[model samples]
Target chain A: MLFDFEIQGGDFATAGNASSQIKKILKQLNVDHRDIKRIVVALYEAEVNVVAHAFGGKISAEINTTEVRIRLVDEGPGIPDIELAMQQGYSTASPEVREMGFGAGMGLPNMKKNTDEMHITSVVDEGTTVELIFFLNQTPPNH
Target chain B: MIVKEIVEKLNLTVHSGEAGLSREITGGYTSDLLSDVMGNCDAGKIWITLQTHKNVMAIASLKDIAAVILIKDLKPETDMAAQSETEEIPVLGTSLPAFELTGQLYELLK
Candidate 1:
């Protein structure tokens, strides 16, 4: 199955809709509970990242018998240093965002921790694109 | 244990999602960081936080959390209350701080 969702920037009210929908679909497909949790966690983080930082974004998810692949592309002030951004305590969110209990600098790290394979690419002035792949057959680490 | 028991014991005000007061509670997670709760909270747990936004409800529904307790007498946003009603995950409130409520809850569950 293939799913596509649009993410509106700074729209906290509607954020996580895509993740919720994807989770429901995964459950309907009878995906493992553990796997569903991992995927939803990663997707929710990515979705919130767009809502927090980007102008807008799109999420593309492909699910098959073997794996689930999700790509999030956001047109925003792209990450200048992917390595720095990946650090657990690095965040550029505004104070208002932090007050809402987001922007803890844990979003990207949590995304990486939940997904089996993760890739990120960005341009200075354009946007960032993140690809996450999870193999359905393998047991997650420390499971 | 179920959510209603905690609400009664802790003196938590049920602001919305009364339909979900009967939901089961397995554990509790105390965190204001949305990502932290998202990353660590397990299914059937009660989330303790000060965040009162609609996104909180979104996270609760996605994680299959039993209920949410807003600390420090905070209340949920309008959209949050609406979503709580729709999802049937109770949005509870407490006058006590997170530390105190969590401690009492720990005793009750443990």
Candidate 2:
């Protein structure tokens, strides 16, 4: 199954809508509960990141018998230092975003922690794309 | 324990989602950080926090949380309560601070 969602930046009200939809689908598919939890956690973090930082973004989630692949591409101020941004306590979110109990610098790290594989690419003034993959045949690694 | 019992015992005010008052509570998590709660909270837990936004309801629903208790008499944002009703996950409230509410909840669940 393939699903696509459009995300708007600073739209906190709809930030996790995509994740919620994906979660419901996974439950319907009888995906392992633990893996479902991991997938939703990572996806929710990524979705919120787009809302908190980007101008907007699109998410494509593909689920098959063997794996789930999700790609989030956003047009916004791209990360200048991917390594620094991946750090647990680093964030560039504005004061208003922080007031919502987000931008605590945990978003990226939490995504990485929950996914089996995570890849990120960005341009200085352009945008970012994040790809996350989870293999269904294997037991989810303990986090 | 179920959420309705907690509300009765703790004198918590039910703000919305009263339909979920009978949901079972396996545990509880206290945090204001959205990501922290998302990453660490488990299903069937009651969440105690001060965040009033709709995203809090989003997290609660995604995590399958039994209920949300806003500490210090904080009210849920209008949309948050609406979503709570939609999701059937009770949004509850109290005048007690998080520490006190958690302490009392811990005693009840323990």
Which of the numbered candidates is closest to the native, going by highest lDDT? 1
Give i-RMS (Å) per prediction. 0.6, 0.6
Pairs in clash, predicted candidate 1: none
| Top candidate when judged by DockQ against the true structure | 1
**Candidate 2 docking band:** high
Q: For residues A1-143, what per-residue lDDT tens digits would candidate 1 score against the true structure?
A: 89999999999989999999999899899988889999999999999999999999999999998899999999999999999999998999999999999999999999999999999999977999999999995885677
Model 2 misplaced stretches (Cα beyond 4 Å): A140-143
- Model 2 achieves a DockQ score of 0.90
Candidate 2 lDDT over A8-123, as tens digits, reads: 98798898999999999999999988889899999999999999889999999999988999999999999999999999989998999888899999999999998889999999
How many clashing residue pairs appear in each of the predictions shown?
0, 0
Find the 10 residues in a row with the least total lDDT in model 1 chain B.
B47-56
lDDT string, candidate 2, B19-86, tens digits:
99999999999999998999899999999999999999999988899999999989999999999999
